[model samples]
Target: MRAERRSGSLMAAPYAAFLLIFAAYPILFALVLVFLKWDLVTTPVFAGADNMRMLATDTRFWRAVANTFVFLSIHLPLQVASALMLALALNRPLAFRSFWRAAFFLPVVISGAVVAILWSNLYATDVGLINGVLVRIGLRPVPWLTDPSTAMPAIAAMVTWKNVGFYVIIYLAGLQYIPRSCKEAIEIEGASTWQRFRFLTLPLLLPQTILVVTLSTINGFQLFIEPYVMTGGGPLRRTYSIVLYLYTNAFAYQKMGYAATIGVALALIIGSVVFIQRRVIGNAEAL
Candidate 1:
């Protein structure tokens, strides 16, 4: 028994070391950095709560927060609706189903910067695919990335398109576990197609829905690459993200302590939003 215990510890040593170095140490150092002032040049000063105090009244920080929420507002519903609809469609028998599945999932594995760059050209004001279509149809071209009103929406749409396939797989897995007997029973109850789906399929997928909500919320807060590459958080900062602001503080301004503060705040915000989502969705599921 003692020999077996020793072997088990040996097997776990690498994982323990990984957590210590990559996860635990970073978190601890970030927490410590939250109360100090350091620019990576001078000695770190203990500023007590000044970092927190400044963050509380920072207009630009608040604007970035609001911009993230705006992105989420457009993203969440589109992500869920598109993924669910595609999942439902793909769950049925179709020609080349496997190929279609692979095609949809291709973008998810692509590099984020590559995806952003591809979409940037596609969203260009003139000499772009979308605008070319509009002009061919004799309609006015809309400035997708250059207009403040449309820049974030365009990014949200791109993100939804890129990530929807992942959620489709999740919903597909959930669909499989749904007991065949329940589906048959619903059909035999004189339930119409819409009635069966509404009364059975939608309700049975609540857990998957909740999972999607939580994950997409976290991704929404961590948005950086898309805005960074496409708009550079431009068109009047409409697409500025919290992560981008944190990067600017740390690298551009050399405000490591303030950057750490922003990082901590972002973590807190992600946690709080995800917690609220789980509670709300879980309660709805309970009902």
Candidate 2:
């Protein structure tokens, strides 16, 4: 038994070492950095709680947080509705089912940077495809990325379009777990389609719904590439995201300690929001 235990430890050694060197070390160092000042070139100096104090008073940081909320306001409902609709449509036996699924999921496999760049041109005010269509319809061109009011919403729509397929697949898998017997039983009860969906399909899909909300919320908070590539957090910083601000602190300002503080704060925010969401959803499910 001792020999077997030793062998098991040996087998796990590499993974344990990797975690220590990569994950654990970075996390611990980041926490430490929050209490110090370092510019990557100079020696680190202890800063006590200065970083945290500044973070609390920083309007720019709060603005980024607010921008994230704006993004989520448009993103979450659109993601759930579109993904659920596509999943339902694909769940039915249809021609080119595989093709349709693949086409939807193709954006998921594509690089986010590429998607942002592609959408940038599509969102361009004058010659853009969307605006061109509007012009042809006797409407004025709308500045998607350049306008403060429309910038974050435009990004949210693009993100939903890019990621809806991934959630469709999630819902599709959940749909498969729904027992055919249960569905047939509902049909025999002569329940209308909407009645069956509300009473049956939706409740059974609760877990997947929770997962989608959690993941998309996290992704919305961590948004960087889309705003970075498309708007550069412009149009009055309406598209500025928390992660983008953190990046600016670290690289642009060389404020490593403050950047680390931002990182810690962001983690806390994400955890709190997700926890509240899960609790609210779980309670609703129980009811």
lDDT of each: 0.93, 0.96
Q: Pick the candidate with the highest lDDT.
A: 2
Residue 235 local lDDT, model 1: 87
Candidate 2 lDDT by residue in tens digits, 224-274: 999999988998999999999999999999999999999999999999999
| Superposed Cα deviation of residue 249, candidate 2 (Å) | 0.7
* Candidate 2: residue 60 Cα off by (Å): 0.6
lDDT of 1 by residue, 159-253 (tens): 99999989999999999989999999988888999998899999999999998988888988999999988888888999999999999999899
Model 1 vs. true fold: TM = 0.98
Return the number of clashes found in candidate 1: 0
